[model samples]
Target: MAKLIKNSFSADLVRQAKFFKALSHPARLSILQYLAETKTCITGDIADELPLSRTTVNQHLKELKEVGLIVGTVEGVKTNYCLNTQAIKDFKSSAISFLEDLNIDTINCKK
Candidate 1:
């Protein structure tokens, strides 16, 4: 069996990676946009608003929920889904900090 390599990156980097990975898919991004636009917890039939099938939509929602980008609450036979504002704020800070640390100057470009 091959040996598993240890992750040497910082905790923040790991978290940022998870967020990026979760947002990498278009379906997940669309779900977030829908939640934000609705501005309220949605229950039942979210797939109707998207181009994807119910199963596909659920999988995308699962990924977002896993990353704390959205939250879902079970109500009777349905589940209500909404954006996790705190998590979104935290992710925004993490992403901003990472990009700012790069300190790229547009003035120093190749000819």
Candidate 2:
């Protein structure tokens, strides 16, 4: 197997990649939107809010949690989930900065 070279990239780029990967899935985006709209920690079944199965939703939640975009606390039989505002803010800043740096309007590629 080829040696892993992810370490070659800057830390900010790696973190932004992780954030983008976590947001790539519609299920995960929906979960984030739901949490943001609710503005409160949810202890109930988040799966019910989406068309995906409970297991699938759980997987998406795990991805979000791994990216530090969501916070999950074990509450006995259930896990309470909430958005990590600080991380969200960081993601927003990074995404905006990265996109702004692209300056797409000035790209003169043939249409």
Candidate 3:
């Protein structure tokens, strides 16, 4: 596996990459969609709603939480997870800004 040279890129690039990577898996995407649809859900609730096992769902949840896409709160023996609205907003803005800065219209490469 190729190692990432963190010093070679801007911090924003790294951060954006992490955000995209967090959304890379289908399970992760599904988990996010489910969480968004239902304001908050417990681990068991998520497992029940999706086809994945509870263990697999938990792993996906861990990845989402790592990137601040979701937040989890422990209530007794269960963990309640919900979408992180501000983080989602920030990621959207970052993606939009990146695309806007691309200046694709000005590029004249022959297709």
lDDT of 3 by residue, 15-107 (tens): 999999999999999988888787755454578889998889889889999999998988878787888999999999999998898889999
Off by over 4 Å in 2: 1-7
TM-score of each: 0.90, 0.90, 0.86
**lDDT by residue for model 2 over 27-95, one digit each (tens)?**
899999999999899997899888999999999999999999999999999899999999999899989
Q: Quick one: ranking by TM-score, best first?
A: 1, 2, 3
**Collision count for each candidate, in order:** 0, 0, 0
Count of clashing pairs, candidate 2? 0
lDDT for model 2: 0.92
| Candidate maximizing lDDT | 2
Rank order (by lDDT, best first): 2, 1, 3
- Estimate, for each residue in 1-111, the C-alpha lDDT of model 1 and write its tens digit: 123336766677778899999999999999999999999999987999999999999999999999999999999999999999999999999899889878886558878
